[model samples]
Target: MPSREVHTATITSDGTGFYITEPVFYAEPNYEKVNYNNYGMAFRIQAPPGAYSVYVKTTSDAADTIVSVSGMETSRLLRGGSWDAAKLVPKKYIATARGKEWTYTYVNGRDYLDIEIEPNKINTPVGVEEIVLQPIPPQQREDGSLPTIFILGDSTVKSYTFDETPMSGWGQVIDAMFNPDKVNVINYSMGGRSFKNAYTEGRFNDILMSGSIGDYVFIQFGHNDESTDEFRRFGRGSTESMYETYIKEIYLPAIRERGMIPVLITPMSRVRGNAAPGYVYTNSFINRKFPDIMKRSAEESGVTLIDLNSESVKFYNEIGVEATTAVVMSIEAGETPGKTNSGSYANGHPSKKIDGTHYKEALAKQFARIIVTELVKKVKAGDSTAAAIASYLKADVRVAALSGDWSKIFPEMAGDTTTGEGAYYRNQIEKLIQLGVMSKDPLGNFNPDEEMTVGEFIRCISKLMNLEKSTFADYPNGELSREIMGAILVDAYHAKFTSKPKYMTDYNGTAVVPGDPDYDPYMDPGSRGAMYYPLVSWQQLMDTAQIAPHLASKVKEAYELGLIRSEKGIARGQMVNGTELEPKVAVTREKAAKALYFMWVLQQAVKAENDVSSLK
Candidate 1:
């Protein structure tokens, strides 16, 4: 059996064969250290003969380094990646890098892979390890005719080599779910890149250069975007601030201009343990936070959205958290799968933190299948363009296990619960949930009957309206009243509801001192002080609780817009099949969530009609 040992060797820092990290033994006068100012010194791996066809590995959660290899006739492979040990930045198959600067020949007759490691961030360690020369493969055919899907995002979407084994990205192996003869999957995602970074660093620009009209772009960036570090923050200041600006100005425009389709995707949940009984995991980062932002972007930008994050969440819930932990990057020490001739990953746990963030190949395949299933389901359901794209996606086996209803894997979604499969409001319940407008608890229970707290209702309204969380004290909590709901509804839709939210153009307009729209308001507009003493509404006056008597006018307005619903068969905002009751009745989580989703669907309908009008 052929093994990497016979073909690859690590280049050593010194002329003699020795180890600093991995196997370090190679003769090269190209590498030199450069001063890195106050923090630490920097170095470079220069080459004209620069480590041709070599696979580089970086370690310690370090995604800070960038590699630029001067291309020479002697060098076929010229890309650097995150450490395979951490299972990040999957090793390359074809020569690929962050930028499009791979064409420089004979730097003093020495082909070089110039690696410039930036000063490391104080929070984490970063280092370059094993730089192995890869065996040259047969020349690959250039087939621009085949429809290619370029994946863009973070490490979770990058392609991992077989040596990484169990830890794999769905985008890397999603090709198996399609007929390669017709569809080509090119994953350009790097570990730790925010979608914004993908554009800022020129990966998206490269796509503009390479992608043809018929090609597709799948973008799912949130993992690293959720970073607390401002330098790495992509999801930055939630939807309105960083996220909205980037999608509207950069991602959507760039992909659409090339005549290629852009499919916005949400990041999937990690197998972070600590589950409450019944439900597996309850991380809402991807479940609600990022998905909500992306969905809004897709809606405003007119792009298709594939809710992979929601689908994965459903799958995890059905499989149970314990099983999912194992399915992810977990293998009990010696329990690692038998090594293939390709190579083997180091056995056991990399650290005590556990590999909840990554998945094994088997699980990656399933997740890949889930993506295909979603594509096909949407295609058949009246999406002509999606159907056209689906024609290229030829899945046979892996997706066979999942039906069109794979998204409804959870009992709550399937209506196979205390309410039973044939329960009333089942479809409404499922729609609100499958869309992830609402989600079950970590225990895998929807708690549909549980009363909705004032806080919970505000949260649901925010999700439905895609409202921006502006300030620190902007948090919602307690039993909700008509007044609070009115305040929330008004604030959520201030952008389009009452009137299109106007940008602050004048400093003296109100109390603002300087900067127009850029001025920061430190107060929550929906707080009690703001919402109090407004005109009472018909709905509130009707409610004996006298709830929200202060904001009656706005409450009535929201009711007119059909965004509110009480537990009654026929009432304001009662778009769902049936209702619970009249106003003053305590709201239930399920009911509030259902009402929010209904409002969102209605808004989408209005948007579609407006689009048609514009076309006409």
Candidate 2:
């Protein structure tokens, strides 16, 4: 058998360090053709700090082998070879580093090794390793607070373990946008279960028992309830009748019994038919009965109704069939399975599959805003007279306008006003600027038409808002580099404004040869990725102004609310220009008009709700 030799070298700033490497086997052996082996070779090396070691461990497959290190030692071994078992071997080596340089060599066959060293004078883990598991405690629910929401549905509302990847149920996202301290949310949903099962199997009862006075319940079903297969189907009318039973027999009685409120939600529509343009009621036969029955039930029960199906349809229609499909589909092109890819359709269900019937976190958040808007409206007509419905409405409008962009909060500065700019966003920007939360640049130019640099854009908003800053002497120039905008970037990162990748180029230094053995082109700027940065950005600024962090807690609060994501698996610092924010993006005066007009409308809605409540 032919074999190859490999060698590796390392250098440390201090004289005390270690070096380790593995040998690469280039030849492919046909295990099936031959009785390859009953055993595999293993190598090990142990050394103290200021010493070096090298070894190789082979596996049947190269990918299965891993190189790892322990304190001041190194080793290599093969895994999954035709061999059934192998004895653990230990080897020790000693070496002297001239200055800070160390080298290692190995002969032939593929193998892996890991190296470890004593804590160098300069290197350390990034802070203490802490894993926070429990949900952050909700802020104080003072004497007066936003109405608590209880969500009850099926897989469409809550996902199954099988459906947890890539897409979380809409309920998860809905729970994120509100202040937990003010609005307590309890999502009681199970995947593959429907309204009938929920009530019969004790889920609904569980919610009722947990309910408190002044709380609100939002109920949506039909996805699983409408399933026609005998094995899974709950029967169409049966589902509707069960819905009625819950409203009259369960929901109403519980609410009235406990002085809580009920809000009926029509089942969100499902995406069906490949050739047809968009999502419709799952089957026309059942659709007519479900929606009408649910609507009537809500009316008869004197409960506020939110037509989620209708709203979803309208919103999808506005975005067009393809865009809507992209929004609903489970998998987008150029994505791997098991990884949550964008554009929805991973499974037949809404979240995992990216179909019209379900929503991804982003869209679920929007839907939640819609539901909250209606709920607030209803609350305004009751005893909560001081509660501003406008706040809810403004939140919806702002979220819709921002579409996840924080920078759009300042319309006068974002400059999205254009004849073609959608009225939705235009109005949001105008209101935000008017509210004095955002402003234009010093040049009297909002630069509404320009793509914002990471530094310029993050810093602009950071300065506008009084965010925290850090100074590090170890950073470039004995001070954290200003050009990199580390201060704002770090703050944004902490606040979840931007995401960094697992591996990112060291942009602070001059570019190195792409293929150099010593070159790690993908070095992350920080340990965490950008998706964790919750703060809004320029593209976000162009969309909605209100979702932008207005207070210090808003940043952390937004993170807890699930309003932001972090780049957990990717690399960072490769110049993420806001492709969505085109340069010279002229803002049409009409767009501005639409924004202001909507803000007025939202404000009026709030005022109206207040008035109604006062009358009560």
Candidate 3:
């Protein structure tokens, strides 16, 4: 199908008078029937002061080529292409303000205009208008300085003044923080935007043009880009891609274009969950995840990243969760909490609604403080003043003391010390020894630190956990040999305790054959076996069935849950030998904390569904 071609002419105010030009075709036209070679051309002319009749004329155009003139209201049609100059009746088109108004006229063929109209505001049609216009002069400081700062972000930083309220955005707050004589803040931020959409809409271009040299531009986003559309998910890769584009395309270009500096800020933390008086409420809220990624991306991108998330977290922690909640709720309830000026329930969005996600005036001020604090440090260090503005904020360094003692640090591992090589496990081994799940060497010494052999480890875990007796009871009887071990491993595999073997070989120094007398073939021992045991010891396995994975998924789940750490990426298929489980490996407190933490999580999950019926 042939597309319609509409010729458009743009007119703008040039100095005093209006300037009009022909409509230029941006693209070549596709010809069709009716000889629509030229659809038509239209021109925009400045409406003269007061109402004036306007018409168009083409010297050689046929009468069939229609000509029309339209003002702000009425329209007129002309029969002849070229009409007698005196015969045209000019209409009254009142032009007010020093602004240009466009009037369109269709000329079948383009030509220049030399028409004249009466009642000129000024004598020379090309000179300034003589209404003795008093311009509202640009704002000036006592010292006559005009410093500029530009901000780029999503809705949070965009200017949004309430119609009847004095509420403004964080951008406005930021402007207040800086000296107007030294800082002219220009907020290029838009609401409901992401890094990608901002570029698609030419917001970056607008910033570049509006910004001046030495101007600072602060960019904060992440609430929006962390979305999964049809094309991409805001996972690590996609988020990194967008972050890079923001830096290379939007941020860096703006800085280079105006010799300005760009500061990257991680989004402010959302007020999720409840806050206490002396403790900050931190929980597994999903909205909190993306800000960390943004901070990391900013640091990796080498831009000045203001750690707003961490700062907010610190602020929350300092006031105690209850106090924070009181502050938030008080503001939300529209009753001044007498302590903090946190506004009403519109928290997440910029609206007057109290949401946990959005910030109110108080929080915005806090964030501004953080920005300025960091900004000033950079500035004092002889960095760009643009960067200094963000450093002007004062960081809230006071935080409440953490409750509880060091004992709570490893609450989950409080009672379990039997798996890794240590004296406590030695006593526990005796209990297992009596159960026949484990045995000491003939030398009268229980090598408590040795790495367990592949065969021995499997047999012990299987028997101690009753895995073999219950599930593989009908299996071929053997001396708990490699073949039986292989069968048990298969059961474990199916149960998802471990991943499938990646290699295949036999103990006889030969790859397993399907059918051979020497084929130790029930399982492939050559594969890289499970790297870490899910539980540190069989005691843990028996004590907490909640930690158990299906025999197939156990090892994988354990590794994933941080129950076990892999050595050289390989979970050796060896019995628990004393020499391998070295107690002097310098286990840090954090590692113990992780183990205990997961144990707590497991216990909580179990307790949450106490009854067997509930479990079902």
The local lDDT score (0 to 100) that residue 27 gets in candidate 1 is 22
Cα miss at 114, model 3 (Å)? 39
TM-score of each: 0.43, 0.39, 0.36
Query: Which candidate tops lDDT?
Result: 1
**Local distance difference test, per candidate?**
0.47, 0.37, 0.37
Residues 1-616, model 1: lDDT tens digits: 0001211132234432222222222222332121111122123354322113544455433244333222111122344443222343343333443321222111111222333222234433334454554422222235556777878877777665423333567776676556788877777776667755554344555554556676888888877766553332121223335665567655676565556778888778776643434664555584227767788888887777888878888887776655565456553212221122221111223232346677654466567777777777777677765676677765443245235433323333433322322222333344455455566676656666667776666655555556655511243577765455545655566643554211111101122222237533342212212110111222333453454455656656554333453333322111111222244556665556545544443344221111010001
| Index of the highest-TM-score prediction | 1
Q: Compose the digit string of candidate 2's lDDT tens values, residues 469-549.
A: 232221232221112222333344445324322112211123232234763424432221222121223224242233323
Q: Model 3: per-residue lDDT, tens digit, 1-616?
A: 1223332333335455432332332322342221222224334444321112233333212222323232111112212221111222122222222122222221101112212111112111221122111212112233455656667787566554221011224664666555554557666675556665554334443454444555666777766665553132111112555555555544564455345566777766666534323444553226436566666656675667676667767776764454333223222110110111221111111122334554333344445656665555555565654345543322221110022121221111122222222322222233344345555455444554444444454555555444554565444443332223333444544443343221111111223232347633234322212211211322223212332233324433333233333221221112111112221233222222222222222222211211111111
Number of the candidate with higher TM-score, 1 or 3: 1
lDDT of 2 at 468: 37
User: Where does model 1 exceed 4 Å of error?
Assistant: 1-144, 231-240, 286-288, 337-347, 395-616
- Candidate 2's clash total is 75
Residue 107 deviation, candidate 3, in Å? 35
What lDDT, from 0 to 1, does candidate 1 have? 0.47
List where candidate 2 sits over 4 angstroms from the true fold: 1-147, 159-165, 229-239, 272-288, 336-354, 376-616
Q: In angstroms, how far off is 243's CA in candidate 3?
A: 3.2
